[model samples]
Target chain A: MTMFTRSDKVSETGGGAKPPARDDTPAPAEAKRPQATAQPLSHTAPPPPPKAAASTVSVISKALKITGQLESTEDIQIDGMVDGDVRGVSVTVGGDAKIKGTVYGEEVKLSGTVDGKIEAQRVVLTSTAHMSGDVVHQNIKIEAGAFINGHCRPDFGKPESKALPPPHKPAAAPPEQKRDAVVGAP
Target chain B: MSALSLSSLVKPPRRDDAEELPVSHLGRALTVRGVLDTEGEIRVHGKVLGRINADCLVLDTGGLVEGDIVARDVRVSGRLNGRIFALHVTLDSSADITGRVFHHTLTMAKGARVEGRMPWRPLNYFETLEQLPETRQ
Candidate 1:
């Protein structure tokens, strides 16, 4: 009888302790609950990747027509019509492209029609290129079938003494000096 | 650069035609200070200080636009200091806009900061828009 009673007391205590221990397990579950909530917050963090994946090169597609200045510190690929000046690090003009204004770049590859001048450090005119204006470059390569109407001068990065001075001094100084002479004589 | 002719700018491409056209991407290091006219889509991640005419336009995060935008669909997740004239407009949570948004349909997220009026218009109104009206303010 004593053995049966003692075993019942021990079993009762063990059963009583198990309920509190089960209650204590909820503390860690509550911690896990916050982690579950954090997963949704992490889902929100993925939106920046698309923005980060934006291309570094600027592309002007064939259907586009720009009528102002385009200046870029990176590469530019043009496949459309541009009525404005284009300045870039590396400029590539596609075969169907048409540019009316000057193109300034460190490296320029042309396979299109350009009506204005090209000023570049390195210039390459592909077989399909049709250039109407002068090309000023430090280094140049022209394919056999490329059509060019103007001279190609290897004068890029050279001092502006010959090219710049004539327009600035002669054009400006003559008008001013003549006006001053007339005024002083009067 | 030659001036952008109003006749060329007035003709907005149809939605079906724009879908077949390629998308133009203006990168973060680029700065355009003139008119951008496109029959297709344009995604701007840099700074544009002039008018833009496109079928669809997306101003990505960190992009800055300071002029008028005329498009069929315009989505903004960046900063815009000018007006937008579009049929469909969606302003993301990170958008910071300070000009009027004239659209036929508009969706604005919770955190979007808009300091101007959003006037709803009819579908035909956008289709018949020949030129952008002058800003009275």
Candidate 2:
């Protein structure tokens, strides 16, 4: 009797009810109505401008200088100087780029100079690339004219226990670990 | 306007005026924490948690900025929780600002929601401003 009346009210109000599973949970359903009404009151007010800025490919142009950290869920193309760490999905360091901190990404391509470390799944050092720190990558490509003064290790995403040993060698050694993986077939 | 005032507002003294500075874009999914000093234009579609010094700054519709902004021209269509010191300021319809805007010229759209004061300073005020005034309010 009273149950039928309450359900009819719920349906007629907005028809937004979840089909009650057992018909025995009338108290909880009634409680949801107050919250639903509260929503409209706030919705009528100025809406919060869409939250944080959109995440698209961020481009740091040649004239810009960032002195702090930069984090992105998308790609980043840097043509400027960054003093702090940069974490992105795909980081592309352009010809005149200079990064003083660590760079973490899925794909890191360098054509400029990086003073810190690079940890990525795939790393590409172009002809003009000048890297002075260590690079930890799963698959890496170093062009003929690229200048790398640091250790290049193929240990990205590997468990820490097995990642022991720096494999430090002479500057002439050409990232044998990753070359071995290529021959072993990644 | 006096010749002194016109020169101050018409053009800001920037390094390498003959060079065409490229535009930098910070996409929506990016979050930058630190000082970004640039000579060119910067479009922020992402969140910036630190101070920004740029020639021109555009905060797109979905962006949220939380620090002081020092720029020549500032256009906001997003949310800003910090102060702005600029020669020219334009607030779009979707702008939701909480801090003060110190500018020489300000144009605010009808639907913009501003909570703090919009103080208008002379053109020379921006040119001579070496540092932003400390936040007292």
Candidate 3:
């Protein structure tokens, strides 16, 4: 039979998953600027900056079954099972939904169970979510009681390539001392 | 590149009303019944019985449904042993559907298999294909 549950109630086990490592370290000069020029603590008034507010339009109820590839330009919610690939701007998997294929979206929130890989800009695994595949995203958050297995990699907008390090080179010694010994004929 | 940054700024304001997020897996101890009417999209990965009326209905691979479905667009990638009526029906390469399907457009990808017949009518189709001559008497 079919059952519907929210995305925040999937009872998954295990600890949280950490994000992947970065190769290059940002320059220290740029990092120190914020700390060097500290503003005085002001409790009186602070104007808000222009914020980028996100919009959400529709919701998915608990009674849909999709088997083939489903692609959309708008945000989507899944409360049922999907057997094929799914691509959307944003996706939310409810606690009662079961996803068996890959998911490609900008933002993905999981409170249920996903058996395949997930690729998104931002991914959040709630306390009730269960994931069993790799996650490739720029940002990732795992809440308590979530069960996740596999690798987590950062999304830098470039295809990840396996490159080896450059060959080592020994440092050369100074040339003045050798020239002085030859001129002295000692 | 700088002008592209302004595109987001000129975009419309955010809406407080948001869509519902999807639920990955179904509850272990719950039974679903009756009809599910949705305007957007719905995917079922668990067992579903009865009628489902929606815009788009997807049955993911490995999902099972033992009922009838009526929708504008219907797709199956898993296993379905029920009746289906839609404007367009597509079966992915891995789908295994046993029930009859009535649609204006039907597409079955390679590796997909169906064991039912498609009975055409002047105006409408039956809820279950079992009432047809090929399935029953």
Best by DockQ: 1
C-alpha-based local distance difference test score of model 3: 0.59
Predictions in order: lDDT: 0.82, 0.80, 0.59
- Itemize residue pairs with steric clashes in candidate 1: none
How much does candidate 3 score in TM-score?
0.40
Interface root-mean-square deviation (Å) of every model: 7.0, 9.5, 17.8
lDDT of 2 by residue, A1-186 (tens): 889998889778745455554354546644543454354212111112233535478999988899899999999999998999999999999999999999999999999999999999999999999999999999999999999999998988987734444444443366676688889995
How big is the positional error of residue A151 in model 2, measured in Å on the Cα after superposition?
0.6
For A91-117, candidate 3 gives per-residue lDDT tens digits of 898898788889888999999989998
Off by over 4 Å in 3: A1-58, A162-186, B1-137
Task: Give TM-score values for chain A, per-prediction.
Answer: 0.61, 0.58, 0.55
Estimate, for each residue in B1-137, the C-alpha lDDT of model 3 and write its tens digit: 01011112112212221134232222212123444544434556555555665545677665677787765557787788887766556677688989888765555566789898864432233233334553331
DockQ of all predictions against the true structure, Cα-based: 0.30, 0.27, 0.03
Summarize candidate 2's per-residue lDDT along B1-137 as a digit string, tens digits: 01122233346344465147777889988999998888667888889999888767888898889998877768899899999988768787799999999986666666899999999887666766664355322
Task: State the number of backbone clashes in model 3.
Answer: 39
Ten residues in a row with the worst lDDT in model 1 chain A? A40-49
The reply for model 1, stretches above 4 Å from the true place, is A1-50, A161-186, B1-16, B131-137
Angstrom error at residue A184, model 3: 43
DockQ, prediction 3? 0.03
**What 10-residue stretch in candidate 2 chain A is worst by lDDT?**
A40-49
